[model samples]
Target: DANGTTWIYKPREKTAVMSRIPLLPYPMILLEKYERDAELRATGKLLPVPSNQKMNAYLKEIADICNIPKNLTTHVARHTFACLAVEYGMPIDVLAKILGHSNTNMTRHYTKFSEQLIGREMRKMNEQMFSDDVFLLNQ
Candidate 1:
């Protein structure tokens, strides 16, 4: 049963404890629905949280339903969150906070910038450096 509030799980080894992650509106709504379902099941009923294996199986089913070709796992969701945040220009420190990493280095493992993105940034920099006005100014 959810404590009706979100809690962060922090590892003792790390100073960074998991802090309350504010869910987006849709997810918050979904959480409310799940909580209500859990409440209903508590009434003379037993509905336990699924095991990791069961949860992964369900996640794979969801990916299949969505026609996603890649394998779906819990870790993939975390990685995706980090990668997307990086792509969207979120600072590494902020990403670390979201991922509950005590050190920024730990968060780096989750961030993977595509080669195409790197190339794009390089091209932008090159274009700015080699612009006609800049080149003329150098002469």
Candidate 2:
């Protein structure tokens, strides 16, 4: 029997590792409801895990509904996750581990930073190192 947490193992990596992902309270409750309605066991794997082809087809439909211009695929979702995580201030090392990347260099390839994000980070650095006193004093 397992608890509310699960580990995702990447055996194909050069160095195999497991990532612990917790099921937050709201999702846990929904999962419990699904289990009860589906008559699933604690040990049973979740059902209706769609195949890659089917998942890609569904993603295409979703992209259309969202008015996205690019092709959507599983790899695209991975890149999206990487981009969002970095854009939202997740550390590169932590993102690397979450992405099952063996090195930060590999993880860097997956993340694309926007010019605005770069400028924002630079501005934050400047604010931290300098103060308004450097600008002007009370007249």
Candidate 3:
């Protein structure tokens, strides 16, 4: 958090949500992930929890290594996630809740209305409105 906001994980307001992406769960894949997590994870946690300054420093180092011009921060990551979520058709109300926003308007502020999203939604609407079965005739 670049805004100096600190978070405490409460039972009701869970800080983390664990999910499994739909992929082939091969033993080799699982083993590799476990080994990588063991090397990278902080003690008693799934990932290293560094301070804001340290995290930003790490991001800066990574960006430098990757030759990225933009300064990457946690806010940047959150914004990117918001944009992708909207693009993927996650409801604004749902995304707002996940983003800890009080309203959908705030969520809208986080996402860009890209042409690709518009085109995809329009195509989906067309499919729902008129499909091959909708135009069938019995002779």
Report the number of the highest-lDDT candidate.
2
Clashing residue pairs in candidate 2 (N, C-alpha, C atoms within 3 angstroms):
none
Q: Which prediction has more favorable lDDT, 1 or 2?
A: 2
lDDT of each residue in 1-139, candidate 1, tens digit only: 2656544344533454546465556765665566657565676322345676888899899999999999998879889989988887789998887777779999999989888768877988889988845665535
Lowest summed lDDT over 10 consecutive residues: which window, candidate 2?
Answer: 6-15
Model 1 alpha-carbon drift over 4 Å, by segment: 1-16, 38-49, 64-69, 119-136
Error of 1 at 99 (Å): 1.0
Instruction: List the pairs of residues colliding in candidate 3.
Output: none
lDDT of each: 0.75, 0.79, 0.73
Q: After superposition, how far is residue 56 of candidate 3 from its true place, in Å?
A: 1.1
RMSD of each: 6.5, 4.6, 9.3
Q: Give the TM-score comparing model 1 with the true structure, all chains together.
A: 0.61
Candidate 2 local lDDT, 11-123, one digit each (tens): 54445566544555775666656765443555465434578899999999999999999999998999999999899999999999888777899999999999988998999
After aligning candidate 2 to the native by TM-score, how far in Å is the CA of 107 from where it should be? 0.4
Ranked candidates, highest lDDT first: 2, 1, 3
